[model samples]
Target chain A: MTDSVFLDSIQPLFQDIHAHFTSQPDLNPQAAWDELVQSGFLRLLLPESAEGAGLSVAEALPVLMAAGYWALPLPYVETALLYAALPDALADAIDGNLALAVGTCGPGEPAQPLRLGLHCLDALVTAKDGGITVAPVSGDVEQGWRLQGEVTPLSQVLDIRLLGTAAECLQLAGAMQRVLELTVDYANTRQQFGRPIGKYQALQQQISVMTGHCHSAVMAAQLAAGGMQRSNTGLSLDHHRVAAACGMIKAACQPVVSTAHAVHGAIGVTEEYELHHYTRRLLAGRLAGGSESRWFEQVGQACLDSGASVFDFTLANLS
Target chain B: MIPWPQRQTLPASAEALRSEVRAFLVAHPPAAAADVRARSWMGFDAAFSQALGERGWVGLTLPTQYGGGGGSAFDRYVILEELLAAGAPVSAHWIADRQSAPLLLRFGSDSQRRELLPRICAGELYFCIGMSEPGAGSDLASVSTRAVPNDQGWLLNGSKLWTTNADRCHYMIALARTSGQHGDRQQGLSQLLVDLSLPGITIRPIRDLAGDAHFNEVFFDNVQLPHDALIGAEGDGWQQVTAELAFERSGPERILSAMALLECWCDWLRLCEADTGDQRTLGELVSRLAVLRSLSLSITAQLAQGQSPVIPAALVKDLGTTFEQDIPAMLADQIGRRGGEHGRVELMRTLAYTSIIAPTYSLRGGTREILRGLIARGMGLR
Candidate 1:
């Protein structure tokens, strides 16, 4: 599974970011962005000719995962996605924290709420007029490129949405892992009825179910990430990618979220404990951009439209 | 942490294998009815299995020395996907191809492997697992079956309950107490490769809810086994059987049990204009299937790399079975809501068969509770 040599080489960068955030949860956004830029993190998806790291979305998935692991309060996930989707020249010229937006950013259109680190966003990457449009938060457009037809832009928008959702799903997977660890630690230590709660069959059952959900969440995210990578390279049915992203988000929003707290009992609710950081972000990520129902509907329609059998459809898109 | 490694797509080589399997299925499609095909791996046809054996598709993972193909796990995975997606009847040699051969290869003695592996690879021998007993279902460690030492070898007593296809199988790898008492649980247990033709053995087929007689209750009345029947070292049955369960739980069989019915439903959806609700339901089911397959494939990769991945396998089986059961339940809801307007008679028939057999998905291999407990312990919760 660890086939990417470049991913292996950049392991320390992810570790450094994880370590930095774990130590200083309140670190300034600009300071973190500068450190990331110096490490060539934002340029990971750019081509080598542009002095970028030349990493695929699949290769840089771990970075997004680490962002969720530490609950890093920055726009690294959005910025990384933009780098993957934007043109090489424009990606090279970008110089500030990035955020993603959907829908046309027309003059009379209402202000879009940035999914993450809104105050830190320099440019908002959005879809407008059948193409990718970059609108600075200051109400001036930096670059606007229109493609030939409505279909391409819609597909591009779908790709961006799928990538963004998949990225957040990876983050959710990371946070879920930490939540599992925290709940497991608590279950093993917290005494109940004169014994460790973890020893009880009841608690063990719930934690086991939680563990299953955590593993499934990871699987869902990886499926989506594979879709993202394939969408970048060449031909892939959009329905499968949309379906995978929906699955990822739905898994993240499952009962695992609440069960983590249930295992922690009252201690999980206290601010002194660290569980809320990951849990809160997990909750937000599920509702961000588009909900699971919306994306799932697209997949549903696609399934109906695809003339192939469901098995063939899955093999065509998923494999 | 659950070692959910990064997702890896099948190699380019898999496409060739997949095409071959699909072509083979088209040439030798299961002649059973739609509902029978909905049974998928549970539908038994010895002739079809022998046909697969002739094509070197039966025991693809076993070494060639045993008359096998000596292929990797991915190769078998590819063939299995096509077979399952087409609802091929593979139950005749399912247990042997899936785990019995692997168990024997790993824990059986040289003579035992030499005698049995070839037949298994040829799909001439059918094997059933004798793990659960009348008293022990999910509590497998509490098995009461006894294999006491005797002048002949061992005198086996007690019975195995819920043993699938025991009547048709040539042999059984039974978990019995070799030394310890009943409450000793996992201790003193040994797996014995019992020839089902032994004089004192009796097998009775049990009828399931779906009117199928796949389940059997096997009674051993002082059935004697030779000295060479013992698999692996004495008192190592628990470990051997645990490894065997991993193989049983992590395969494509666990997740693709309802593919036949699903394919049928999708065909109907295409013919009839499905409403948004029907579309959403199919979409949800498809998404879950994609993710579950991804999880199962990850475990297969781990197995390829020589990792047991016990917990991940258990987790997959649990989630996979849940997804399997959800197919019929969700389809039932959709079919119920439409008042038979969109549901074809054929689709309803397949759905009825699938719905009746869905509960077995969780009960077979390992029950949901037992699997969850294993996962919890793996997470260090117990």
Candidate 2:
């Protein structure tokens, strides 16, 4: 089936799950993830030989993008990364654990423990010193997931970051998409001096900038997804380009989020409106892979260390 | 939904074509240094354009019967991506290969195509666009250049300002009033294929802020033209130009304008002992480029399918130009913080050049404000 058809099959399931979470007061993410896992979405990236769907990163990106579209608050991104990168830590996730991917920014601080799916059985994975390690939540949860952090090489961590950031970016991209939707919807309906506010050039430009960013975020997420696909095949990843892409998108979306809120006005700021759900994720996901600054700094490092070879690199691995 | 332009997968043959493009770039490098070379599409080099023609890269997408490669838009995109990345001077044949040739094929007579297209593909001819009159830049509908009908064809008696390469180009595709007065607006506009060599045509070069004289003012004092000079149905210039722009706006050039600066900056960065902060910043720039590229490629893919995606194309030019302009501003700051005292002069030269000319990025391909309006309309916001 085509990617859109495959995505169409799973989108309604997510919307149903979205309805379930939105109906709850606390936004309990557990039930929806359990349903998703049961539906085999959690194993969408697992090798088919392992009885999983064996979908490539390119194929799986749309799934996460869909989850993002509905403002999904699950740990699918982390779970997929852990399953693909560290199969040793796969039991708890397969045994009904809601895997929350831990993302930490800055130099010294450890990745924060899972808040939505916190448990002794749930595993938390993080990148450290050019590698990644997956450790289960253990005693004195404040020191959770890092008690036995094991280094696993740069490529594995990049794969996870590539996947994790792709997920975060996709969701944020979705959120931006939603914000654009909200803005467009609002522009067409919101009357100022009698006609729709969209008739004004000022408002139009604001929405246009938002459109630019929204489309950009979506494109960035797709590129990262496609990049990881190449890396997953044991081919060259152009880690420099991937790092830049994953990181650049977060930075790129900052203005988009703010512009979306501005165009949406006060109603967007309220918790009563659905805009906050996606806007909130837009901010949180900005830091999911790493803060924009952190990722961009890594990109600069790649350019420095990559020497002349990096100059030949294009944005996509297609080149 | 926030306009999620569908991600298009490239053809399987793209890889082989991409390799060939890279090999061609490696074989034919531009003579300009890191700074001057970064001008990309704005940088003019006749020899380089001729060499590209020799390699069958000039008009690869045109039909083979017209002495073209009969390649896809994606093929042209791949070749352009490589050239732009290397900061190749593509201005010589830029206008002709990009929009002129395509427009000719779409609207030109069979004789026009069979005659002009072969030379265009061979890089033996160059064409400049005459859309932006001094008073009618963004408001294209207000164009007043009149082409009064004559027994033979038309008598053109107006000037085209801000015409790129008019001083050096062999021909021009100008929009002139044919049927109505200025009040008629887009209703009376018509496209004319004018030969620069014709009498009564005067091209006065206009040097821009970057010390480049690539722009010009071509005044026509009752210039005579044959009946065939008129392209497409008369009074359809507005619609034809609008369609031609979809091709012009959607290309790898939009993102690759500052590529030379980016490449040079990255090369300088590689030599420096960069910290994590510096590294990430550089990575972020590349990331932005890659993402913009995906958006650009999406439009090209649509073009390859013979579909004119005006909205996405507008977004690419708007967003892509924003990124292009940012390269100069961001790198100026980067050089001060990182370049230290070494090679600061060279870095500043590029920054200065880019910064000076950067304002035109949005202005050239339908100003950002105009494009945003189009994008807004596309999104159904207006």
TM-score of each: 0.91, 0.89
Off by over 4 Å in 2: A1-3, A23-29, A48-51, A88-100, A103-111, A114-121, A126-163, A230-241, A315-319, B1-3, B8-12, B17-28, B40-43, B338-344
**lDDT per residue as tens, model 2, A1-319:** 1256558878888787667655454544556666666777777776766556777766777777777677666666556645665443444455554465754333344445432222232545556666666544433333434433433333443455555665566566666666778779987987879999889999889888878877777777666666665323332344654566567667756787787788778877886777777767777777765777877776656556545534355433323
Error of 2 at B76 (Å): 1.5
Error of 1 at B69 (Å): 0.8
TM-score of chain B of each: 0.97, 0.96
Worst 10 residues of 1 chain A by lDDT: A145-154
Q: Which pairs in model 1 have colliding backbones?
A: none
Docking class of 1: medium
Q: Which candidate tops lDDT? A: 1
Clashes of each: 0, 15
Proportion of native contacts kept per candidate:
0.66, 0.79
Candidate 1's error at A215, in angstroms?
1.6
Candidate 1: Cα lDDT at A78: 69
TM-score of chain A of each: 0.80, 0.79
